[model samples]
Target: MSGRFAPYGWSLVLHAVVVALLGVSLHAPAPRPQPAAAQAEAEPIQARAVDEAQVQAEVQRLRDEARRQQQQEEARRQQLRDEAQRAREVRQREEQRAAEVKRRAEEEQRQRAAAEQERKAKEAAEQKRLADLQKAAEEAEKKRIAEEKKARELEARRKQEEEARKKAAAEADLKAKMAEAQRQMEAEAQKRAQERARQNATLVQQYIADIRNKVERNWLRPATARPGMTCTVLVQQLPTGDVVNVRITRGSGDAVFDRSVEIAVHKATPLPPPPVPELWEREIEFIFEAR
Candidate 1:
């Protein structure tokens, strides 16, 4: 039993030595290839053994640096996103303002168009009203002219009829005068003389009455004149019935009243003609009395 245990112990010692060598190799750095010329010129280089604890500390520092870099990249990405969002908002605000400006401009244009249209419409309406008034005026003028022409024609016709009637009356009077002349020739000379005197007297009375009527028509009585006031006025006239002079033959005591009557007689100039030419006088005396 002792002999079998001794052989087992030797095998264990050899395995233990092999395990230690494997552990050292696992921890060692990989060898780098050197140039042949450098290896020949230099002395034998001794390799420094690696420290496991220091290597572990360096690996941990690298991991920490990598983590910090990742965090910085994330922060940068977030900042870029925020800037993009702000830019998008600014663009939206600008678009809204532009839309508002365009809407206001369009509204102003519409208002101006409406105002212009209304002005034109008013002008057209005014023109139409004026045209209507002018048309009515023209129609009224035409009617007035036509009526005046008709009235003139009627007046001319009436004048013609009046002239014709006067001519016919003159012819009848001429025939009667001729018959009377024949009768006068057959009468005695003394009877004819008496008849002529009577006719002369009648003519004188009628002529005096006509003069009185004309003077009375033109007379303007003075306030001083009384009802019983009377005066005689002497008047001188021409063959054409025009008054040449007027004189007061008698006054009614009031000089102003007498002067007024004299003026009235002169104003009634061109005294009525006598029926008989022989009855006409250059100077005649007439009485003025208030009615």
Candidate 2:
């Protein structure tokens, strides 16, 4: 088994095999004595001792080599198994790392999708809220406009009614004033007419007195006249107070007295003119008495 003794051990096994071969050849049967003078010379006989211990040592060396080769083969197989196990562990680690990467990627994708959905939902809600607000504003505006229009119409109607009432009051006031004016004018006219009539009557009396005084001044007393005699005489006159006719409407019993009254009336001619034009008449009558 020691490297230093291996060559000596191989040399000893070779020598043993040569000694066995020589022994067989030397111990073979002698041939018949060759005829004298034709026989070859015989070599010297060499004797070698076979050592059992050296043979045993050689066999042990062969066994040791075989054992060493078997140990080498088993070592190689163990190394191959270790290398395969290491490869399998490396492949498993790589696969685990790849699976982790894929899981992370998938999770990121899911999160992004969720975020996008949330954003879209919020945007839609905002749009709907804006639309609702706009619709409410429009309705409120319409209501305000309608109320304003109604208020304006009511105000216009009220103003028109007020104007109509004022107009009616004015017309009533005007009618009352006109009726009062008419009454005052009629009363004034009646008062003026009565004053004129009174003045005309006074003037008529004065004229009648003048006529009687003139007739008496012109009378000549009849000697046959009796005291307390009276006569009614009718006289007719013109606008110039000139007598046109005279007659006795009632005579005294004394014909001479009545005749004298008629004569006096005629002598009175051109009787006094009336003070007013309207008082002049075509006929006049007076009473005469003897004083």
Candidate 3:
């Protein structure tokens, strides 16, 4: 309903009801006639028809007013009903709009929450990937370090083995050299003693004469000396003018004669001098009969 009509509409209805009530009060029913007043009023027979007509007209007028008032009341009530219906439709429309806004708001909230969840998931995945990469790198580094350590150990072992081999070789060489040197020394000493024993008897005939002189007078041998017979000797001398040797100065066999000659030499230890000191010799040669 229009603002201009809604408030005034009820007020007009109230004013009409008040006016109807006043009309009813003013038009009260006629009272009963008194006998003397009735006789006096009966004397006006000439105006009776006009009075009847006027009364009929008055009754018709009152009936028409009641019909008009009823129509006005019905119209006022219908207007009020239409205004109430319009107000109800307006309220319904507002409520529907409010519901639509609420639904949209709810949808927006859901979308935002879903987006946030997705974002969080993405971030978590990234972090996990980075962590995995770091772990892999660490493992690789560890493997590399382990391999290096193993290689170093192997190198150390190899070095130790090589050192041991070198030391062993050096020791073996030293031992061999020492043994050879000792043998050489022994040979040299023997050679030295032999050289000291005699002036080298280069002439075979002289060597045989020297052997004869060292033999006993009773010892006998063939006149012709052997050829290609050679030997060597080692000796220890006593401080007395006598010599004691493990055996005689070199000999080819004829052992009996060799023993006899050695005995004679021992018995005549303070040997007669050679022709001169220049001819003196610690070694002598002996040649014997041919076999």
Models, CA RMSD each = 30.6, 13.3, 9.1
Candidate 1 C-alpha lDDT tens digits along 1-291: 455245345544544654565578577766566688766533443322233343445444544544554455456557767877788788788877888888888888888888888888988998998999999999989988988888888888878877777777777777777767766665655577678777777777778778877888888988888887888889999998899999998888989888988888888889999897888899978887888
Model 3 clash pairs? 197-282, 197-283
Model 2, residue 29: what's the lDDT?
A: 76
TM-scores for all predictions: 0.34, 0.39, 0.45
Per model, state how many residue pairs clash.
Answer: 0, 1, 2
| Model 3 alpha-carbon drift over 4 Å, by segment | 1-39, 42-93, 162-208, 213-285, 288-291
Clashing pairs in 1: none
Off by over 4 Å in 1: 1-81, 154-291
Pairs of residues clashing in candidate 2: 241-270
lDDT of 2: 0.75
Write the candidate numbers in order of decreasing lDDT: 1, 2, 3
User: What order do candidates take by TM-score, descending?
Assistant: 3, 2, 1
Return the lDDT, model 3, position 51.
Answer: 56
